[model samples]
Target chain A: MTEREALGRRRRVVAAVVASLLVLGPLAWFWWSSLVPANASVMDMGYPDTGGGPAAASGHGHEPEDGPRVSVATLTGPSGGVPDVELTLTADAGPIEVGGRTVAGYTLNGTSPGPTIEAVVGDLVQVTLVNRSVPDGTTLHWHGVDVPNAEDGVAGVTQDAVPEGGSHVYRFVVEYAGTYWYHSHQVSHAQVRGGLFGALVVRPAAPQEGVEAVAAVHTYGAVPTVNGSTGDLRVDAAAGDRVRVRVVNTGSGVLRAWVPGSGYRLLALDGRDLHDPGRVAEQAVLIGGGGRADLEVTVPDDGSVRVRLGSQSVIVGPADDAPDGDDPRSTLDLLTYGTPTDVGFDPRAVDRRFDYAIGRRPGFVAGRPGLQWTINGHTYPDVPMFVVSEGDVVRMILRNSSGQGHPMHLHGHHLLVLSRDGAPSTGSPWWTDSLELAAGESYEVAFVADNPGVWMDHCHNLPHAQQGLVAHLAYTGVDTPYVLGGDLDNTPE
Target chain B: MKTAYRVLAYLVATGVFVQAGAIAYAWFATLNDLDGGAVIDSDWEGNLGHAMHGIVGTMVIPLLVIALLIVSFFAKFPGAVRYALIILGLLVLQIVLAFVAFGAPVVGALHGANALAILGVSITAAQRVPRSTTTTDASAPANAVA
Candidate 1:
């Protein structure tokens, strides 16, 4: 080859080498960076633990020194003659049998929907939670009961998780009477789905004479169960008996409850009774995840009353009798159900109004690729902190455009449904801690900020919550001493 | 050899515009991502933009190298060969600058700024190529330009 030709070939070779390096260099770096562990703490990711202190040795952070302490002594009922109901619950994690299927799950008192604790209004309910074998710690969050801030059971926030072999006591007076539940807040996404939950019923002062049953609905390893049993749950009742079925949706999906054999009244919702609830036939009630619905059914003269929750049936009569026929699509709309009553607080006098628009975006979550859940277009750790002062009436416009339903839940307060899809609610006072939102749906809810604490307002669909569908409802003058994604592996979702 | 050179020039030129389009789309997607204030699951656009930018950005390297190799063989298009080599060098520098930009915002801005220069040089080199063999024959002798 000539000298010029050799020089020309060398130039081409050099160009190729440079080009190859240009392409491969960045790719190699990206692969290397992805493999490296994320050294930053949750607080470093723009969410600082303003109320900072060293995390407790038990893997749970302590509340700020100035924050209110919830002790067993302070949770006592008023002196003299108030009936006190006390119980002990142990949380265990292992392979457990449910609905004929042995699945791995966390359990309370050796059962999935732990024992139901029943009490009357004004009764002091004291429950000691003992963490026996649950690794990663556990704390019982009273789902709907408005307990003291310290007894709220949010690990690292309200209280540190009760370490394994350690115990904590939750005491409060049953002020309002209705169906509520308790579940773990530590690693809640795994623990709650694994079955660390139970139902709590507070009866009214004047107890009505009737046959009552708590239908705690949960999904154990993809199987729908009612009161820990799959298929039909039978309760024998005479023709004239008034049967109250309290349906609790513990899973992260909407559950439709309907009585196929008898007409039923929508008695209560989210632990609050409806005003003059009227009887309705051939309609189902949709209960949001982490929400509850109480239905009263009158047994037929002979045949069984089949109350179906999702695919599981609760037969409230003879076992062999056939279920009555009705179109399941004829679902009851609770927004206009029952007589309308004064909600006491004027929603128009809102102190703070915020728009919570839920959307989905394809992005990196903790350096991983997937479609992530967003609140107001921002993913978790970058989500909005809906700030309010104590006693402020806050109104939130929740719009869902994410192509799926999100059962939005707020801790520490129950929001009253003002309107849905721009239509004003004309029914009884509708209150909820978990409000279900369908895709393309909008809802306006208002709540008085009486409870002062840094509370989580997030999607109750625990998986979505983990995918960044979470935000904080921070009260002015209140801060959380806890940090997320630390050594404790405190996954509040 | 001249025909191969022309084809590679055209391909590299097309790739330059594609890279430009990808970068433009990425910029628009980033804007959309920023506007996603509080909306969940809106990161798809941003992620798509990043992927497109990376893919097109990496693709430019080999396209430029092939154009350089083919143009070098033509011998008459010495200016085209020089431009191709310059673009390849810029691309390498741009990749390094982009990684550096992760830790320094100012460097990132420079990385973005250098991309336009690379595009300009790529297009210039593609324009210098003869549209057909007839044009190449009608032009000056191979040793004249060199």
Candidate 2:
């Protein structure tokens, strides 16, 4: 071969090597950087976001050794006392009937939408969880109850999941009376969707006169159900009787609920009563994922009333001929629905301000490349750790530019809605634990950092949370003995 | 290496076709659902067609393009490197347009147009590979440009 031809061959080979390197180099780096350690503390996972408050000396690392340390395991409810309400729930995997069709799913106490647990205000509630045939372990989270950190039931963060045939106990005091729920938090994206959940209702000290019902809405596969049944939940009521229905959305999306025949009042939200809520008619109420809405309706004298819940319905009065409702075009704006009242705490007197900006960007998560959700432009484990001190009034601005809607949920605290899109909240000092934010929507909320522990603040759309749309609100000087992906194999999303 | 480059380019072109078909199916299915009283809103989880489009567009085609770029260096065909680079550039632009289209759906028109551009460039790149050329030596007629 000629020297000139040989040189051309050599140069081509060199160029090939360079091109391969250029193509593979960044990919390898991103894959390596996206890896999360099998066992790592929630405290050490992400960067510290001070939220303009006092900066931690450790910068989201371990607490300063010189200062006193508090472990999350020590944060518990009152102990060594007789439980006011006690029950045991067993989780098992089997083929259950959803909408009269059998589906492979998980169940609690031999039924999906397991038995409702009722309590009065200021009563101590205790529950024992027993995992039976579930391959993946299970832990029950007291949704919107604001239990102590140890009783929060988040696997790998608050405690380890209960393995098969193993048992765990959770005890907390019910401080307020309204609608709430419980669901498995381990492998929650799948377990909750498969129906390992139930309703929790707390009543007032005085006996209520009206008929009460619970409509725990869930979707098993593509079948929407209420209280584990496919058809409308029927209530036997006479004419001129008053009925209160508690609606809980356990699915991973927004739920639109409306009444077609009779007007209803949105009595409560997220287990809190609205102040002087007026009557609502011809408008649907949007309940975000993991949210609750209490509606009060007066049975019509002539016909039955139908409450449309997403894809399911609840019929009151005579069940034989209930009026089916249409999905309303207009939604009730909670921001201006009720009369305003003092919310007890001043939102303007804030100690910390944080920005939780949700966006989507192309990146690698756990070595998988796609368009992943970002919290403040950073993905999981590298996302923000909102640091706060106990008793501080924290104000946060949540912005969603991700071209999708997210029902943002914060554990252990109920955020008071101050405003949305710069418009002040004129209704009943709206409070929520799950706040829905659509694309290009922004909300300002405030809450007191009275619950001191490591808490998860994530999207209630479980799949999105698994896609790195998760962050945490951690208190200073507080650490946890548990870790994610540890020997327990706890996967908490 | 020349054969590998050609196969990858053809695969990318086929991927564009799959994307077009999948998105079309997704919209048609969505329309049928809406007609049957299914509310399309934030709560709507897309149908299977959208999932297919996403997987192919994001993972399958991009990987093929990268492989083609690597093979182009050693293929030794005239204009092979230039064609591969153009295809890669168009694919990158296609992805960016897709993301932007979400916030402003009007930009979806551009995304649709760019997909055609990618399909065209990918086919052009594959055609640049000389037909039935097995010889890799310097004496082969395929290396005349070199």
For each candidate, what TM-score against the reference? 0.69, 0.93
Worst 10 residues of 2 chain B by lDDT: B137-146
Q: Write the per-residue lDDT of candidate 2 for residues A302-409, one digit (tens) a residue.
A: 878888897678889875567776887799999998889888787888899999999998888877778888999898768899999998899999999999889999
lDDT of 1: 0.72
List the candidate 1 regions with Cα displacement exceeding 4 Å: A1-83, A318-320, A324-327, B1-146
Worst 10 residues of 2 chain A by lDDT: A57-66
Model 2's TM-score against the true structure: 0.93
Error of 2 at A31 (Å): 2.2
Worst 10 residues of 1 chain B by lDDT: B37-46
Number of clashes found in candidate 1: 20
Writing each residue's lDDT as its tens digit, candidate 1 over A176-291 gives 99999999988888899889999999999996787988999887755567888876778888787889999999988788888775679989999999998998877889888899
